[model samples]
Target: MIKIDELREGFGSFWGSVSEGWDRLRHTAAGALTRFKPGEQTALPDRGQIDDPLHFPAQSWSMLGGDVFEDEQRLVVRIEAPGMEKDNFAIEISGDTLVVRGEKRFEGETTEGRWRVLQCAYGAFQRTVPLPAAVRGDEAKASYRNGVLKIDLPKVQPGKPTSVNIKVD
Candidate 1:
């Protein structure tokens, strides 16, 4: 027979593990999670207006998962941003941060009935990631495929220090 105290302890351990996982995720992906609201003119996105406004809320939130890697020659950033065209994305470097901005338009059924569940977020979103080293932003190249945006930026090489010798008086 299992004692009630033991059962309580087991449940507490499981919940503690779950709580720790959530805290770790929150810390690692602090700015990756974003909230997007409906545009001024449209309720949802560029297309796919919800037939019943009540079915969907005015705002929704989604997470953009990404990774930043650095090598001896260059730095690479890959972001998971589905449901968008290649033209929709705009990449820029502000200081030591890499900024990715885009809009994920909703293309739902035009003749649809009430949506059962609308969890996907729409509208414009921006995600910024800090870089480990200074990069040559002007020479950066980017591509989008398979719902992923990859950016390759060459690292800026440091100039050699110039030394001068003063004549002794």
Candidate 2:
């Protein structure tokens, strides 16, 4: 037979009771209200928004691109670009998308008394964002302020889907 003192000492005083309370809390109204509870990872991306990123042409990188928001008048894109100038960046639009391409270049020369390291990439990066509908590419304006580049694109009305019905005798 297990003594109460031994049970308390080994179970951290009230572990079993706390575990039951946790299970109850997990199944409470808050948990039952929505079925989108936290779940374990079962497939690639885990986010469920996209499946198998390797199959897609675009690659998602946390250090590459960022969010895009739009308003009634215009669509805006803000990219986090550090240690780059406006001259090194270029923005262009093709079809219903906007493409940003830039190349990073850095060189350093140091003697024995000093050490230098070129940590930034020197190749090139291209990021393309698809628009909701259509945007005026010619009038799209971009500005680089601080370490962010903001692109303002003129927004256009979205197209409506037509309904189809069939009549049978």
Which candidate number would show the highest TM-score if scored against the true structure? 1
For candidate 2, give the lDDT of residue 8: 75
Model 2, 1-169: lDDT tens digits are: 9999898798884887898898886554231121111122211222333243343212322254456786667788887776678886889988887778775443333432332222233335666666665788878899988878899988666334224698988
Deviation from truth (RMSD, Å), model 2: 16.0
Residues 1-169, candidate 1: write the lDDT tens digits: 9999999999999999999999999998887897665654224532254454444445667888899877778888999998788998889999999999887777667674656456778877888989888989999999999999999989897333235799999
State candidate 2's TM-score.
0.51
CA error at residue 18 for candidate 1, angstroms: 1.5
User: Per-prediction TM-score, please?
Assistant: 0.78, 0.51
Instruction: Judging by lDDT against the true structure, name the best candidate.
Output: 1
The 0-to-1 C-alpha lDDT of every candidate, in the order given, reads 0.80, 0.59
Candidate 1 least-lDDT 10 residues: 41-50
